[model samples]
Target: MRNSTALALAALLAGAGLTGGCGGASAPGHQGTPPKTGSSDINPQPRDSLRKGGTLRLSIQQWITQYNIGQVDGLQGDGASILTLTEPKLWFADDNGVPAANPEVLVSAEVGTSGGAQVVTYKLNPKATWSDATPITWQDFATQWKTRNGSDDRFQLSGTTGYDDIANVERGADERTVKVTFKQPYADWQTLFDPLLPGSAVDTPEKFNTGWIEKIPVWGGPWKIGSADKTSQTITMVPNESYWGTRPLLDSIVFRALDSTAITEAYLNNEIDQAPGRQPEAYRRLAGAANTVMRTGGRWDETQLTLGHAGPLADVRVRQAVTNAVDRAAIAAAQSAGLPFKVNTLGSHFFMPSQDGYRDNSGDEGRFDLERAKRLLDEAGWKASADGKTRTRDGAALKLVYVVNGNGSTDLPQLVQNMLGQAGITVELRKVPGNDYFTKYVNVGAFDLASFRQVDNVFPSLLYPVYRTGGDQNYGGVATPEIDKLIDQAGAETDRAKAAELLNRADALLWQAGHSVPLFQTPQISAVRPGLANFGAFGLRSERQYVDVGWTR
Candidate 1:
């Protein structure tokens, strides 16, 4: 559970078009060649080229609200990115989002069936310890499990699907081992327990939610929080001397809060070593910088328009009309304009085009057919005004509130507004502060339609929160029993082929219902210092081995 909260947070920021190029793959036409890893390649470098001591400087869109990412208010992209260096996951997801075991923390994780129930036994590495030298034990696991299982609402967790499904968590012989028996089978079992918090951090609701808001006392990975400055909006981390795994290459890592618009300037000024280059304008500006390389590739992140089921968008026909009225291709082209690679319009809400089991469920809904859109709106009781500038239904104009983060360029939303205006829909664009974008607008359902990109996990089963009825992240209020059934069926499946089939079927329902419009899969574009190695966007791996990130001197 590598900060599951951060996963959604990253998606939220990506959706807002802030850091669209953060995860997975280089941009379409990378100009430079990456160093090849031959048989003589070092563990984390090419031969003896890695330099071990330097401060890695990075930038983020906003300051983290809380240190604990599991809490609703604390779940954020900045915090999650920082935690990646401080936390230990049972497994790390590859660039393609596939989960793989991490032997640094886990000796082995065995999954089996006992009495028709699913069972997982995790054996911890004997040397695993916190920064304070406390042994990582089963008690820590039980503490986190009890706080986040959803049985108790005081902890304010982001999601509890997996934890709630567990029948029991018991110690296996000694503190070094534990067994988790699931009341129901969870096919994505490998996705759990990145690192369990010490008992002090999760022993109670108050401790779980507010204890780490200012400082995270517990540390279990290669790096521990060194210093956090609220005034300067920076957090510095240093290597955890007690780490049992191979020592990290960098002496320290510093994450600073900077406006998304200033990232390119910062990189140019040498204030930061690397920054995402998803924005076409920024990529163009940094394309010829000295000692820098721009890498790009397709990312799992996607931008889309989410309809609020309670407003004028309540009618499925109205949602369909809105989806059809917008020209998705134009929006994608505008975002990718001047870039070296061609951008494709994304069609599936569940899987990217490059991923397996992807299907173009967009069908006619994704096509820009103003005539069809008008027909659908007219059928939904909205009639165009005499001047043909707007639609009126029962004496009220078909007006919509479009909410987005205020930090990035408004070109995309403005383009969407113009396209929908042709269909007689009036859009009022609301630019909220970037820090408050998720809590004030997205989570509160304060907008009639919201636009943001979402980052997805490798396992489709992990997507239940966005589509499942009454799920924590289901801000669209999409409640369909049939879709829920398919999600459940897919999660219960042990066969990968069958799970993909069921998930696609559920995704089809999402498309037809006009729950959301799938947009383009943003490419991961970033400019890094020439000698910087083992960092930045990758195609097959999502998680970064910070221990391996260094400079080739």
Candidate 2:
């Protein structure tokens, strides 16, 4: 249930990130904790055993104005709940983080070599067709690779990770077959082509960047666009009648975008059948709701503080001081309060403690040491004021802006503010609308500090785009040479074990770099109707698809 690499790291980091923690309460006497090895809690129920039909209502923390997940502005909320229903993933992962090809889109996925270069061969499901009735083909695969390959700068992407490692993507024996040659033997090749885009959506830079803005121009999964009302900030997905796989039982699924507090209210008011129990209010309200069941699972996710590169944090020592000042234990305790689950503070950038490759690479940077924080500031030329309440250097107060999206726990930022204040640093809490959180804030380097969660994947390389310099998700603005080398070598890594070591070494540097500080594994807590099947806190199952999600009588 828990898992690494630049050779393998890219795959590991690739399928992850961007968010507010999803947390909640378990039933009385229920311990929502993961086994030491980690696990998922989706309340599995076979398709045939489920009820024939029912609408599933869900409250989502984020609504995508830019619907193309590969694009620069493409981050969705935790679990990407909307993407699961409306998009296509060629593969799916079980609780142990092992990948399996999705028969709905891929017949078989095999790894081998071509001219000594690692290659992956994919056979498309013959029955797989786009919403427009066009057959899903190798061209779609090729185009997706090309657009995200990082060759053209016009196409602002969230990641060039696995795509950039490819040597080429060509057709195989048939139009339905795809052959992708990698420049090196990257680990977890299955992480590629996730929510695979149609060529029409990615064939050109202009289309790839803006085509899906405020709209889903294409559909490739069990569902198609029913309506996306911007005014209401809700998306309605209906079953795709042309889908080749087993027909989805639900007539429609509606994802309503709401803040954490509103989501809790909606759940308690019975306006939404399923809601994220991340908000404390939700946990309290749903704790006694007869029809609601609390679901918690272990995940390859962590809530972190990303220090913006510009401003006072530009100095590495200042960043390190900030990291040293944070009491992750206290924050974790607060976030997990009133819940049976045990949420521990995270220590590595690449792996969760419950995962196999995990190591406490954080070292001294991860420790709470106010004295060391003061020393680091002093060494960085920041001096405490005569009053000793705040630091100042070069006519600038040692102040940092902490941006909050208003969708996550308010306690986190406040805690941060109070903790930093003790270290003679002034932290200003700036609240932003959830909609503009990333595009207008995190992505633009608009704040000195920010809080968010990353939902990780089996393929740790998915994190490449997150930690590298100018990485799409690198809001922290801290990328070290060693980290870069590991990222470069990740695609070249053939040995998973060695690759994991390489990732840990890089994470050590990540701690040393101090651009980002790991908080706790963002708790995945959900409140779902008892009848809901195959839907809940999906731990490390990043490769999951929504076809099997339905009601169990």
Candidate 3:
């Protein structure tokens, strides 16, 4: 099947990416070669009717270090652990990535702006219960907000720029109802309610602020944590029989940790049923087997080498020279294994392209040009120093330290380094564990370059923390009044095209300023075995949880 798809794609490439003679006499088009789009071959098993009883074994690259839903800092590739087994949100978005009007836990939720209250109200389903069997009520909702706000701790939802929009939340006259008020006209109200924690666990909002409360293990989601071993890298989750909605089809789910090579080997040997974030080559090998391969929309992280406007990098011409020097297309092509859609240093459309504000500025950023880069360096007062390998300005060599979360995608920094080397810049790569890397180092501005990933599913407002000035979470210290203004407008502009226009303007500015290097809009891909049911619910690349899955024996 892989061979056939490659052949078909090869046939299709003849007519595309070619505009006749301008690409030089020895152009790739003249070679009559077709481009690769990752692995073109995948034969997914036909959908099978739902059946139960088989244990679904999965070999994930990462382990579930913490079980707490709200406190777990990183998505950690263990999102299934958070969303499926341990906790439930007010509502889950549909396949289209839009918030659903009706959710399993809540009958309906509404935010009323008419009243001075500026409240977001939710009506809970009476049947819902914590894994411990306590009734989930509006009080729980109120407690969730208070605890998140008061905690001032790691997982404080209120402190997060996204959730800070809420003014306060209160219980309605009836215990089943909850009302929340926002301090400002901002989006992300959905995010506040979605990571709902149990209200019964605490007596006061202050007590809940401690991040450790998550270990107590109260849940309203479909499954409950039955057993887990942090050292052994295994976790077992059992269905919550008393769940308000449809019960999970599997009796239990076991997560086993394996490195990249080990995971692909295990899946090919049929030791595991599924795996996400495998290498592109691994997917290519698996495409021939009687299994299904799919892409998920999100990634673990990204790395950007930013110029400090207040420091030596204050010159706009220097920034442009840096931007023009590196070749994004070459980096993309190499990183993608010759796939046609390799993307390099993308602008501020940081969120996945599916979101309303995503604008593609690949052409505007300009492709790799060694000659142009040399010219820019000369113009910026950076002359080739005694060492041909390095560039110097004001007697200071352009030496940068690039850092990355030890557990993140390895392809990012490597590609950036290669591109920079071609443009005469020296970069030193540093790796740190995921925990200390983001909190102590990246957040506090310890590194010159880093790659991190942020998944914002609800709306465009997710950009506030990453893009705005003085944003607590802004790792690169990138602040642009133009970007902030456009993000603000894009968030409020309900009209699609207008919002895109505003977003594109912001994207161009980001590229022009050299704050971020636009990467590709990654596709959401997933690989599944035959007879796996309801697996597509895992959402693009299995980012979303699979509420329903069973086998067709």
Best by lDDT: 2
- Which candidate, 1 or 3, has the higher TM-score? 1
Full ranking by TM-score: 2, 1, 3
Write candidate 3's Cα lDDT for 330-354 as tens digits: 6545555523223333444554433
Better of 1 and 2 by TM-score: 2
Better of 1 and 3 by lDDT: 1
Candidate 2 residue spans exceeding 4 A from truth: 1-38, 78-80, 279-281, 542-544
Report the C-alpha lDDT of model 1 over 1-553, residue by residue, as the tens digit: 1123433102322322333232322344432222111101112355257887999998877777777766766556567667767866677665456666788888888998899899988898898887767888887777777877888988887667677778888899789998899988888877556545677667888888888786787888888889989899898989988788978889998988887798899999999998776777887677656756665545566677888887788899998898899898888878767565546677777777767777787777767799999999999999998887899988998999889788667888899899999999999999989878877888767888888766645566556877888777777786689999998888878888888889888888887788888777766667777677776655446444588788888
- Residue 121 shift from truth in candidate 2, angstroms: 1.3
- Measured by C-alpha RMSD in angstroms, how accurate is candidate 1? 5.6
Compose the digit string of candidate 2's lDDT tens values, residues 362-423: 89987999999999999999999887679988888888989998776678899999999989
Candidate 3 to native Cα RMSD, angstroms: 7.5
Model 3: which ten-residue window has the lowest total lDDT? 1-10
Using alpha carbons, what is the TM-score of model 3?
A: 0.78
Q: In model 1, where is the ten-residue run with the lowest total lDDT?
A: 34-43
RMSD to the true structure for each prediction, in A, is: 5.6, 6.2, 7.5
